[model samples]
Target: VQDPKHAKKTARNQLHSGARLLVLGNNVMLYRHLLTLAQAKNHAIYIRDVVNVDKQDDGAAYRLFHSDVLEQMYQNELENNEMQSLFVYLFVLGDLFDSYLNRNIFHKERIIMAMRGYFFLNMWAEYIES
Candidate 1:
């Protein structure tokens, strides 16, 4: 099947009479669905750990409780949990990081530029695919 000729011959056999253009199959949703599910599961575990930790160091506990990202996670509405929706949020996050790095990258050139490039490429790929 790796050979184009072999593939063509197989397809030609199937199409001989009135074979419908049937898509055999593809797990297009598998990765996207699993990634979204993992994110949700991780968030749940984080919340449980945060809640169950013995209240010893009030400062550390307070910091975890007051984390802005946690607040955003709670308040943000997840769109349909589709692949497109997941990446949209990721790129937006990456863009925010990129913007923050933009100002300081020139001063710290090498290190900052590397991080910036990562985010920029992430967003760029998402943009191109979408």
Candidate 2:
């Protein structure tokens, strides 16, 4: 779970399951711990970043980053044994938000601006239809 956005839920689940939970200063430390735990448990771990897209039809390259909790979990899984473990990056590009342009009323133009920037970099617009 490299995503800090959803770390709270993951942390809670780990604690509830009687797994030791520790929050290191940085992602590197967290990744190390996850590796150690996976080895000890004899269970393969996998990791991948999950992208949450607000719109399916609106092509966006990268969507909302996963929550921190999720990110850490993913990192741990990846650092362990990505090959054997079932690592999946879930993307909800279409269902995460209403309109891609106006995630919030205040920043109506922000998404559009981002798209323009993306186009400039890639030399083409990528639109994902929901």
Candidate 3:
């Protein structure tokens, strides 16, 4: 378990050290449970929502996992992958590139897109959401 006071720093260090997968606990107890797991395994951990940072690297590989967000991404990726036709593949790739470009430039659009693309978009959203 993590003390709320230290959650932000713990999360930052974990993220900086290449912790790629994240499971968020919306409440203090859950957060602490996750913290304990991370500590037990000697892995760095971060608490979402409570942590504040000025900026984050655009290319960080970390992914925050939550139920609903995972489902959407899974569905989208599956839908994209299951279309056996080349035309569908091209269209998906084109959409992907376009989304990337829009996200790179437009703050609001990026948040909407990232929210659709991954869980915990807020971690990075703060940078662009401004």
Best candidate per lDDT, number?
A: 1
Give the per-residue lDDT of model 3 (tens digit) for 1-130: 2432233234434433333433222211122333332333223223332144233422211222222223333444325432222222223322333345543557666555445534333543463445
Best by TM-score: 1
Q: Supply the TM-score for candidate 3.
A: 0.18
What's the ranking of the predictions by TM-score, best on top? 1, 2, 3
Q: Which regions of candidate 1 are displaced past 4 Å?
A: 1-81, 101-104, 107-130
Where's the lowest-lDDT run of ten residues in candidate 2? 86-95
Task: Using lDDT as the measure, name the better of candidate 1 and candidate 2.
Answer: 1
What's model 2's lDDT at 79?
A: 59
- When 1 and 3 are scored with TM-score, the better candidate is 1
Clashing pairs in 1: none
**Model 2 over residues 72-108: C-alpha lDDT tens digits?**
4455545554321212212121112222433464454
lDDT of 1 by residue, 21-105 (tens): 3221221222223223335634422332233343343333223223243433444424443344323333443333343434644
Query: Model 1: how far is 17 from its true place, Å?
Result: 54
Candidate 1 minimal-lDDT segment of 10 residues: 22-31
Q: Each model's TM-score, in the order given?
A: 0.21, 0.20, 0.18
Backbone collision count in every prediction? Answer: 0, 30, 3
Per-residue error for 1 in candidate 1, Å, reads 56
